[model samples]
Target: MIISSIGLSGYYVNRLVQNSEEIVKDNYRTLLYIEQMQEDLDEIIFNINNKNKTLEALQDYESVLKKQEANITENGEATLTEQLRVGYTKIKAHLEESNADANLIFKDIYSTKKYLNKIFNLNQIAVKDRNERAKKAADDAVLYSSLFALTAILVTLFYIFKIPEYLVKPIKGISKQFQEISERNYNVSLDESRNDEFKEMALSFNKMTKRLQKFEQSNLAQLMIERNRLNAVVEQFDIPILGFSEKNQILFANDRMLEVLQVKKENIIGKNINEIVSNNDLLNLLLNQENSNNERQLLRIIVENKERLFSKRIMTTDTEISNSDSLAHDSIIILDDVTDFIQKDVRKTQFMATLSHELKTPVAAIEMSTDLLTSIKVGKLNDEQKEYVDKINDQTRHIRRMINEVLDLSKIESGIIDFELENTEVNLLIEEALQTVQPFLKNKNIRISTEIQEQLPIVKVDNHKVLWTINNFLTNAIRYTPDKGKIDLSASLKDGEIHIEVTDHGQGIDKENQKRIFEKYVRLNKNEKGGTGLGLAISKEFIEAMDGKIGVHSEIGKGSTFWIKLKTNITS
Candidate 1:
């Protein structure tokens, strides 16, 4: 449409330009010739009156007239040119006479002047008429060009509104259907009745939706079956099980867990555990166990009028979602019935306590016998006899120490040990522990370097237990230190706790063994030992029971530092 409008406008503009060129070529040239002829006539009249060059003037006038005669274009211009030429011929003939009559020549001259004026007036009127025609042509060109442009614009606007209905509308509908499919709504299908490429696309889209719908139904049925099977297995278990999401929402609670919690399934599932924990003490304890830094402990609860022990174990599984980069943590809390195992362990502890007690008496009697055998009044032993006596004495002492360790462990396990907590000076505790290990230190010739911070605060702890633990640390330090190696004992107030460290320059423990060194019956060096392997374990229990912490920091070829942290009576 725009091209057609340009072509029409160009045609009208070309016509308008041709009309202007015609006006300039025909009428304007005729007006210029008449103007020159009028000037020549005035020259002929002046020359004739002066009688100086009348013949030349007449010849020039005649030449101009003839040219004007040949160039006639306007209406009535040719006849007027003939009259102008006849008048000019008569003037030339009169001027050619030797005795020229000025009156006749002048008469002819005025007549020719009249003809020239008439011709000039004719050409001027023609110029005005042609100018009006040219203006009318220009108006027609403007009108026609404007009409074509308006028609083109109207056609363009009509298509601008129509093109979207034909193209963009179908595309938008397809896009909407695609969005529905993304959201798992497979029931949507596009229209396939159109006879175009969109028809093919719609046909394929409908087929895909149908397949997806069938797959969704089958997949949903399988998922339901699997879910039912899983629930059945979890319900059959005797152990209490609870599952929670990262947001602390209770995802699932097995039948056993619901029974132990004394609540129905509907009351807890999909609910925030924190909200439920407020009203249920057992649930609160279970949740608290999940956040506790210590190892999971056994919980005692009365069920069906009988007391039972259950060990709480929390397992956290992190799952990565297929559509996300972040990990989802799911926590499963399992409470297994440990009543039978705990009962057996308690009986074993009692038996051990009884055996150690019985052995202590016999061991004490043997020590008394050795003393009697070594008495001066009894006899003067020979060198060989003295050597045997020394061996017996050492063995007996070792046995006594082992028995004492077993008794202490049994007491701690049975929960019968009492802590005599009191405010005791840090310096005095270090001195007392040193005094107990003095003999061993002397035997190894290990130098004891004491560093007590000035104005160190006292600690609130079980005096007997703390002293025992410190003595055990010092003894272990002395035993591990090479002969003539130096040992360090330091006490300082740190972080509202009194930190007492015993360092030994010995063959240090490796990184792997340092983790379980405090566990019961764990010996770092099995070949070089005189301990029951329960000393550090007992010391750990004692320190923990008194609200303190004990750990060792060691590295290969760098010696070991065994330290204990006890709460200070004075806050730092």
Candidate 2:
């Protein structure tokens, strides 16, 4: 644009100069030639009319007219100069022919002079026209030149400053972005305002930053997913699990832990564990502040003034596992409730020990006294006295049986029962049980059906103990079963274990009472000739002591099936 403006200004300046030259060379010269002709005409007329027709003056007048003719350069100047030349020629001829006719010569001179005046006036008009044209051209030159100079200066300054700025701005931005990237700032972005390769470079850099941002977000999302999964699992669990950091900051707690602590999960989470550790010795011990390898059991924690027993296991973060899983916790404190089991065990032990030690001698003395009274060796008894003695003896024996059952239960629960485990045939134990309950079987008129498997696998068990548990089951079946009802006894192998089941067609225990049936002195039906309820309880302990599982499958209004499962591993 600037170059074009300069070229245009130069064209306008040349035009102005050419117009000025036309006014000077054409109009001015024509006017000067006309003035010289007018002066010489007056001299020629003066000499001719005075009758002093000097040849020099007449020749000078002719010479001036010829010069005026020659000076006819512009348009219309030639016509006027030609008219003046013709009139001058006629006057000069008249002057030469009749110099004595002054009036006639003066008339020719006056006509020639009128032509000269016409030429001079025409040149004057021509000069005005050329001058006006020159002024317009001059105006055009001034406008164009000013525009050219202004445009050139502005363009030069723009290139000197703005061009470098355009280059350095993006360079600085890209350099600063590189610095930011080195500092791990992935959010820097450049403005892609220009339609240049620089725009593409900015876009590529933006894409790179976007990819970095996406990768970072994806990793963060994965970690959040893992953490949320762990939280969901712990939230739904019933076991009390409390996880904390090394700084004693509680990371999280399960629903059960929150309930046991009587605090909300929101209340405890992110708080220091020391907030809840006030007067909580069990937590302190289980946390292993003493750093002992020993485990803590029977940790009694009181909630709402009600004490609960728990066996706690503390787990610390494994560096190898934590390194593999970034969301792994620092430490976990897990608690298992053992309140009922421990309480029942302690009460049963104390009661049975007291009963066994305190009642054994008195029961024996009562039995001996009743026997002696019945023998009639100390005194002669009447029939009524003898009958009472027999009843007393029966009661004493029943009491002794109940005491023995309690003692056996206490020993079984305490894990103090002497178990002489050996590879024994389960069929033999079933036969022995049948033989032992034969009197009760006959008295109740209950027929025992045996479905012992052929070539039955030998089971590792305490032989006598197994037989005793089987006999207790048979006795209970015989007692609960109606007269003439059939009882089915079967032995089968299941999952590498021997299952001995005794099914009786008797009143079944209810579902609610089934769980408590094996508990001490817990008889579902008191009216059904139950033996102090300790028989089944003691039998359960005995079977369990021999590494066997015993349970009764019963539903209300349905017959009961009692089963004992023992592991089968035969070794001679």
Candidate 3:
């Protein structure tokens, strides 16, 4: 079939070359005839010495030009129209100017002849080049045919002489071996020492077949053992474990996965993960990661039909050793049921909010009562009454502070706190925060000092959160400092981070209590002083939300220095 196809193509190619050569020859012949006639007319006009002789020669040349024009038209040259127009114009001008005058006629006719010679030369050169190309094409076709014929003969001999023993015999033997293996017969083997490479290949092939049989038996046994172990693991654990393909096909589903969906493994395996999860949007996210630039993904996906929430974490691993690209591989997705934990968290947050609100009312009432008792206009009071009233006002203020702290905690836990992020100068924010607490400093009689870095780069952060964090540190510092003790507030940019520190001369926090101070209700002592245990905790949350961190260093009876670290760049 291949040889016949090649021969047919070669025949067409040879025919096309012959046709092209004939066309070139016809074009060259017509161009040469026109040139020769033009030259003859020019010679007759240029040699004219009398009016009658020039007219006789012009008439004769005009007849030859007419015949050449007809030939050009018949040859299909696009230049024929231009040549005829020029020739006719020259003839008409010669007839009018000459008045049968031979010299003028000769000038016009000679100019026309020169143009004709130029055209003839161009035609001769073009025709010669085309003829050479045709000759080369013909020679190439003959060479290609010879090579094609020789290749066909070689291919025919190769197949006729060796196909029976090398290809046909081996194929038949392999088929017989497959039949025997199916019948559980292992004694059958292909001979190896037949003095041919085909026999050697068959022997190697038989060895591979036996090894594959053993491997299949071993693999099946191991797979069964693994399936049992997987079932046991799923039975003991409440979380679901699943395996899915890039096409969203489920390869396996553990006991937990089947139980959650209220379906048997047989019903789910080989089914679409989207149909099992009952969510299209989440299914797309999971499947797209199989070809993603990133290798792992953890996301919260809600199952639409089951009305269940899952925290799915997926990772991909390559199974083929010969892929051109590294990313074409299968992925394993682990679906953990987070529905209960999510519900519990929601309840905890709601209780915190409700408790915070309930605490606010009593705190407000106490503040109102303290205001009435302290005001002389409400009722007159003696020295003892005045002191008691002053104490009551102070304690009420502390209660109000604690209530605000609780409210802040609730906001942090529920993610309701508004973080107004923008470009803020670290130095300016720290200065403003220090001023806000300046009034509280008057009662303590502490000397406050600051060391702000010069030309500090601006940071993208929530100004309010940054100030709040600084204020928390300041409050902690002032509360612990004794009367007239020195407190220092400083800021600096270091190692691509902004550091804000507040140091005091008060008794410092114990080492044991310092670590847990960020936790809610983590006061070292209930009666240590006024203020809620939530201030430090709120500070931590505010700083973290702004993508910063807050911590402290202290020694008992010496002082405590609380510091906050913020990144200079704003990124999620």
lDDT, residue 423, candidate 3: 88
- Which of candidates 1 and 3 is the stronger one according to lDDT? 1
Report the C-alpha displacement of residue 566, candidate 3, in angstroms. 6.5
Query: Comparing candidate 1 with candidate 2, which one achieves the higher TM-score?
Result: 1
Native-to-model Cα distance after best TM-score fit, residue 464 in candidate 3, in Å: 5.1
| Stretches > 4 Å off in candidate 1 | 1-180, 187-211, 228-289, 301-305, 316-331, 380-387
Better of 1 and 3 by TM-score: 1
Candidate 3 TM-score versus the reference? 0.49
- Candidate ranking (lDDT, best to worst): 1, 2, 3
* Model 2, span 1-572: residue lDDT tens: 66777777778778777858855676777777777767777777667645455456667777766766666666676777777767767766666675357677678778877877777787787778777777787777778678778878998898789877976886787899989987768888988787866898888888899898887789889978987898899988778998898788988788888767677778778888887677555455666555345656557788658888887877888444433555444889888998898888798798877868799999989988887886756989998988898779778877887888878877776778798888888778887788888877777777999998899887778888888788878877887789999999999887788888988888798877888888878877667552678888888878876678999898666789999988877422
Q: By the TM-score metric, which is better: model 2 or model 3? A: 3
Per-model lDDT: 0.86, 0.78, 0.72
Best by lDDT: 1
Model 3 residue 120 CA deviation (Å) reads: 44
Model 2 TM-score, 2 decimals: 0.45
lDDT of 3: 0.72
